[model samples]
Target: MDRPHSTSAPRVRRSRAEQKRETRDALTVAALVAFTRDGYHGASLEGIANEAGFSKGAVYSNFGGKAELFLAVMDYNLGALRGADWDPLAMPEASGSGAPEPSAGHDEDPARMVRGFGLAMLEFIATAARDDTLIHSLRARVQVLIDAYGRVAAAGRPDDEELPVDEVAQLMAALEQGATMLALSGAASIDSALLRTGLRRLVTPAAAANEPSPVRDAHASPLPDVERVRRLIRDTIDS
Candidate 1:
């Protein structure tokens, strides 16, 4: 009689750092989804931990507090959207009035950049509309944007005598937030049109003059509309 040998292979083990990163990423994704749905005030660390399949201590260890967690979520979401492939500097040139001359050594086309910005805004609004936690998190992000933009405008090129970057950022954030609120409240008509118009106006004052109305013409072909906008956003974020 002959004996058979076992054929099973040894399993590979993950390094501690790799395991930690995996756990951290899972927590961030869970938090993003949970916060978007529950809102910052409503979401609990325990709930996030449960969702992530981690313990409460894990959540606390990774993020000091709810605010830090919320900020991390924002960074996660925004970082997903930024990169050289979608470089702000490569956008289409603006052909309208009040367009800021491209800063020296900065050659991105303003028109395309504005369109991309509009798309990014619409995506954020859409996400917020679907998730209460995201909405709350975004409000905090808006405040940060205002403060950061204010400081930049005050310090860099103060003599430009333009609409303060902080003011523009706040206005954009408000419009996007308000539009999302309206959409969520059954106002489907309140889409990215307002944001597109505002951004265009902000980026190219001359273009604003050419078109008395910022809204794309009512009779104009829809151009695949909302889904197209969403796709662009997904591409930006996922890129």
Candidate 2:
């Protein structure tokens, strides 16, 4: 009877919920790196799983499919973008006369903020340019911008005021994609100089004034399909 003492210790109950959450986090991180490197079409669930040290079935179980995974990647990247290092000019306080000085904890500088945004955007575009899956995701983002601008125009804003939103969004997207491609191809420096210059020019009062107005009537010409065409061309070329 003494020799029959139980050999096994009591088992701790595993938290299935916690395990699932950790799995989802791993898959999302892996998808981000893979999509950034491989493009949306080029990246696969299997690849993401491998990157995350999980099985492909794990990815499928957690994310459903490529589209859902892509959305996850987008959310992850945007989150990072929003957390970028500070810039003073873009900070609300910087635009005001009574703005407080940069405290030891606060890094407020608008130019720096714009530059940070430019750099993050460039890095994202460069990564997407190399991956098929990511390209599709980027195309989706472009469509979103177009749709957003269309809505702004439809909301009865003055034609002149509304037009620049779409135009500026298009220009920013193009510059970002183009610059990323060029930088990746080793054709230009990846710094924000060119982007900053372009942004300044695009936002100039004269340039804004000169932009084509959104149509004012119900029968107004459809928003030019230029952004769609541009995205298609860029995707095709990158592919």
Candidate 3:
């Protein structure tokens, strides 16, 4: 005889909870890739499940549906970009934290930037807009982000009726959404510089905080008119 045959090591059985957790994690990761690649409407539970090596039933068991799944994806990737670039407190330079700077290499591939996490985000926003229930589900999470944004807005600004931090935060939030939509669409060329400038200006505001305050002195300057003409001219050029 050559040698005695030895059995392989015993397989360690995982608990049901462990299996479920693992299953959910795997499914979520797969869903992330699917949503990123196909977007909200384009991604399917079956496809995500297949990608994760689970059956479609696995997704149903773990999540309410695709909307919930995407929300989980957002939660999973909160920093989303994973760079130290995010500071919900992306405050004014006065605080020392300073406003976020544009990524070092965003110009590399505009399409990739949009179609990556940005497209998935836009897709979910569109889906959420049509459904009150979905928007409601999103509001809590949005509130948390807005709260941090509000803090950034509130730092040096007053919370009074003049330059309500609430409105500033909300407006900044809207600008962010609108810009992401336009940037992702590729219908018109939009760039990070425009987004950066919008944030900077909005954070700083047209009216100096000390002079006439933010909301009050908006009309005290001719710059707004100049900007309007410039924007119109740019639009005409693009058209």
Candidate 4:
């Protein structure tokens, strides 16, 4: 029997631009790993380049230096944190809709995602604190997150009943940073589910019954209760 001619098309070589992008992505990933393992001040461009199996020239060509690479890592990790796929049931409109949001992590474990990003963020913040230029840059990136939080809060409720956008953003930011500090201090008893759900509740203006919940027993983990955090935030503001 004559074997059918291979129908698969030949792979086209990547253009220079595409190859450069791949190299940049590889270098970024390697840099992130290296930064996490060795503190930012301790990590080197040479080490990162080697980790990516590329020459030190590739590091300079892609990121220019270690500071740039570290910022890139922060951008990637923070972007992921901000871009998490929140449950629709957590939405303000969920009160009228019967569709329930995923009880726990949605598609992936929120805890792991938050913890990893939080740790990296702490490291980046420490480095940025010492440098005036980097502090300004860090502030700019943080402003973006603050703006994003404001937008989400606006979407959740009517303008008349809506909380101050800045306050909402500040509250959410405090929760995240506090949780991150706790985890890093060996008190990781709290997980991301509580944080995610609590933020939804605080902004959505929905009754407790309509709030989305964890799919499994929340008590399974020793994490801080989302409701508690929500209450504290509310009380602090009201008081």
lDDT of every model, 2 decimals: 0.55, 0.54, 0.62, 0.64
Q: Candidate 2, residues 111-175: lDDT per residue as tens digits?
A: 23333333444556676778887688787765654444334333433435434566755664565
Return the clash pairs for model 3, or none: none
Candidate 1 TM-score over all chains jointly = 0.51
Query: In terms of TM-score, how similar is model 2 to the real structure?
Result: 0.46
Candidate 3 lDDT by residue in tens digits, 1-239 = 69987799888999999999999989988987887678778888999999999898999999999889888887765444222344332321221366343243432222342357576776687879899889987887677556656766666463343767887788867776666565456454334434445655566654333332123322111111122223333446559
Best by lDDT: 4
Between prediction 1 and prediction 3, which has the larger lDDT?
Answer: 3
Per-prediction TM-score: 0.51, 0.46, 0.61, 0.67
Winner on TM-score between 2 and 3 is: 3
Model 4: per-residue Cα lDDT over 1-239, one tens digit each: 99889889998999999999999989888876776666676678888888999999998887757777877876765564455543322422222266444455532333443344456667778878999988998888888777767767767755555568788777866766676577567866445455667676667656533866644444432233233323333446559
| Residue-level lDDT tens digits of model 1 in 25-128 | 99987877676556666678999999999899998888887756766766665545332232211222333597454343332222233333334445555666
- Model 1 stretches astray by more than 4 angstroms: 1-13, 81-189, 212-239
Best by TM-score: 4
Ranking by TM-score: 4, 3, 1, 2
lDDT of 1 at 238: 59
